[model samples]
Target: MSMERIATALDRVSAALRRKPQAGIHDDAAATARWDGGLRTRVLHDAGHELLTDMPAEIGGEDGAPTPGWFMRAGLASCAVTRIAMAAAAEGIRLETLEARASSRSDTRGMLLIPEADGSAVPAQPLEIALHVRIGAPGVPAERLRTLVEWTARCSPVGCTVEQPMPLALHVDVAS
Candidate 1:
């Protein structure tokens, strides 16, 4: 969509939101994942979109698609960029270009069930996840842009998830 169109759409949404604040309330979302075989998995959403995840050949997978960690990083980057765009529109900040990157260092030994020399399992968590955002809006003060990026990180869902621990539950069932 054109920039003008996006601005118009955001304006319409803002107007409607102002008119009826309750119109923006949402409570729940659902998605599903199915394992095909080996390390291959397919994630399905109610919106008719699908994502494939797999492991690399070194980890005993055929390398059919990206790993789950890659998807997580991609999601963080995409969500950050999207939220930044929406916030910029709401604040009437004209941006010529925006870029976001998410990255982390992780040990796969535990995930792959590899034992250390001391017969201990390596930690499976990423050391840290970093987000980098670059904005190109001429004449805009660098301080203000930096503040906007920081605000975007605070408001983005994926960014929050990476920064804080959220409640999660899991259940296992067997198919007859």
Candidate 2:
């Protein structure tokens, strides 16, 4: 979509929220994933979209697709870029280039039940995720560009979700 269109949509949503804050609040995203026997076959469904996740052969998968962590990183990177663009549009900045690099670091000791190099236990998940965003817009000041990037990081949904911890509940059911 064009930047003008995106700005218009954002303005519309902002107006709606301002008019009825409570009515505008919603959280109803639902996705289901099903896993079959081998090859790290996991199919996820959300709304009308479907995503397949798999692991590499080194970890016992057929390398059919990217791992779940990879997907998460990609989502973060995509969200950062989109949010930056949205901010730029709102601020009337014509972006010439925008690039976001997202990376995560994890230790296999936790999943593989191996000891850490220092004889300590590794965390159950990745230790850190990093996002490096570079943006360019002619005639825009460097300070304004930095502010846009900072604002995007503050408000991006995926980035916020990754930084914060939320309550989770799990249940298992068996069929006869």
Candidate 3:
């Protein structure tokens, strides 16, 4: 059996006064290559379980985990930070720091790890992610950072996740 996902992001958004930005999105995933020369150690992904605990303690975290979700943990943070950096660079604003953290919960009454519909064992959906980003843009006004947030909200992967509903698309591209 095979699973297929379809995704389409608007290249242009509507604007009241001027034309909106030109941007697009594709699909991606978190995994390592199947082959390596000598080192072949497997790594666990933080996905939903360990996403919250994989951060520094000074920045709102306890920092306890067995190397969880190293791949997905920074998915949103990196993307969002990159966008902010780009915006700041474009405006000649210097940045000092950037960070992202995430937490999540499901409507399972705090019982099941993943809520199931129709008593099916399979996971019905991904839980909600409470994501936050802290960016230190020196010499940049707060209003400009707000604009950067707006732009990232429309462009970054994590930003898109926060904007609309849950995940509705998945794609695995590979050829050999």
Q: What is the C-alpha lDDT of each candidate?
A: 0.87, 0.86, 0.51
Writing each residue's lDDT as its tens digit, candidate 3 over 44-150 gives 34463212223335433345532233444466667777666655655556667767775554343233444355555643233566567677776778787777767
Candidates sorted by TM-score, best first? 2, 1, 3
For candidate 3, what is the TM-score? 0.47
Q: Which stretches of candidate 2 lie over 4 Å from their true place?
A: 115-120
Decreasing lDDT order of the candidates: 1, 2, 3
What stretches of model 3 exceed 4 Å from their correct place? 1-70, 106-124, 161-176
Steric clashes per prediction:
0, 0, 2
Best candidate (score: lDDT): 1
Q: Which pairs clash in model 3?
A: 45-69, 46-69
lDDT tens per residue, model 1, 53-149: 9999997888999999999999899999999898787677889889998999987886767889999888787868898899977788989989999
Select the stronger candidate by lDDT from 1 and 3: 1
Could you tell me every candidate's TM-score relative to the true structure?
0.85, 0.90, 0.47
Tens digits of per-residue lDDT, candidate 2, 55-168, equal 778888888888888888998999999999999988778999999999989986687778777888878678888999999999989999998999789999999988986867
